[model samples]
Target: MEAKNPLILTVRLDERSQRFFNEMRIKYFPPERNLLDAHLTLFHQLPDTNETLEIVQNSKRGVFEMGVIKLINLGAGVAYKVDSQELESLRQDLKRAFADRLIPQDKHGFRAHITIQNKTTPEQARLLIAELSESFEPFTIIANGLDLWEYLGGPWKHRGYQSFNYLDK
Candidate 1:
């Protein structure tokens, strides 16, 4: 079962970046797209609120600037890739600070991607992925704050991610 309060994670993205994503939605992912806005997802929720708040409050805030990377299809869905060295460092710092709350372990193999759509078949998905991957270009954005969002569920529930809190970084 999904968490009662839902699985919350911290993400950072600006209005410009958000707009770019929205345009992409029109040309690529549409209504019932089952896609999420682009952002860097930090650590997930911890069972204990006291511990979670303490860790987040005490954690060092670091600015992350990411170069735009195209979403590539890996036989699943499309995702944005973050190739910036500095951003990776921030990711590592977050992993270390939220060691216990980390939903997935840190690994050498990581790419920042936002799934744009859900397809019925893998073959059809591959075709669309190829087109998007080729058309995407590099964009740059800076992340200065952390936002906590909860995933409600389903492709139709994309906007259901409501911010629970914000932390300046």
Candidate 2:
């Protein structure tokens, strides 16, 4: 049997939001298992191909409207749900482009979010969600680029980044 090649594609957020999410992950996520910085995943397991790379490289940058903050019940953990039409549209475009290559998870509707904690007890997740939700607020985040990474089991290795160039509208 061939070993599966796990690749992750994600949207690169603006500096401020990126830092905020990363900090949250650092503070809340299980230190032993928190191998990756916070990120908004677009495709969980994309195939490594030139076509995929081209699509990311040609993607345009846009301002994503970060909607209300809601807690996601991850069963074993929780996440901060981020609503963004612009980001969803981009993901849809990519989905269509790689329709045949998409995995089952990627075939479904894209739910943009930043997972601050995972692989923990449900009770712990609920406590953190409640604590965080009290002060949560909506904000805007810039989708400046697409990031690709090779998922080496638990730890992901950086593969490449395709920065989006915004066109004057």
Candidate 3:
């Protein structure tokens, strides 16, 4: 049987991008709730099983760049909007492969993003959105691999990681 703890899948960002987003998260997110480093979640729930691990580790995906298109006012938080056809294609491949196992959130529309702030007042969120928007410029971040994490109630535990079929630059 699948473990009760669910799995989360994310696109691994390059070190520089990871560091930059983590810094933003630490500066803006409520500390008590900031349990994870910055991440771009692709799937919120996957079965925690050896099969799942094998499937992920066996992936042949190659590294690619994704566009950081804009900043989103997440009502009570802020996030950087992401867009890339290559990323979308990857998600769709996984979606189809795990169609029967998907939760509603994962099964429905997937808008890729990396949240920088959360768990604050809506007013505070609006202010941040405004402040960040003033200097917002589109950028790109490299997607180098896939990370698997086991949900630990509020915090997450690293499960495994599979680098895409290319050496890191």
RMSD of 3: 2.3
Write the candidate numbers in order of decreasing lDDT: 3, 2, 1
Q: Candidate 3 has what TM-score?
A: 0.94
For candidate 3, write residues 24-121 as lDDT tens digits.
Answer: 99999999999999999999999987878887886667889999999998889999999999999989988887889889999999999999999899
* C-alpha lDDT (0 to 100) for residue 97 of candidate 2: 89
Q: How many clashes in each candidate?
A: 5, 0, 0
TM-score for all models, in order of appearance: 0.68, 0.91, 0.94
Candidate 3 has an lDDT of 0.92
Root-mean-square deviation of each candidate, in angstroms?
5.0, 2.0, 2.3
Kindly report which residue stretches of model 2 are placed more than 4 angstroms away from their true locations once superposed: 1-4
Q: Write the per-residue lDDT of candidate 2 for residues 1-169, one digit (tens) a residue.
A: 6765677998888898889889989998999999999999999999877787787777766445566368787866778888877777888889988899998999997778889899999899889888877887766667778899998888888888887766668
Please state the error at residue 41 of candidate 1 in Å. 2.3
The stretch of ten residues in a row with the least summed lDDT in candidate 3 is 160-169
Q: Is candidate 2 or candidate 3 better by lDDT?
A: 3
Colliding pairs, model 1: 79-113, 79-114, 80-112, 80-113, 80-114
Say which candidate scores most in lDDT. 3
lDDT of 3 at 52: 82
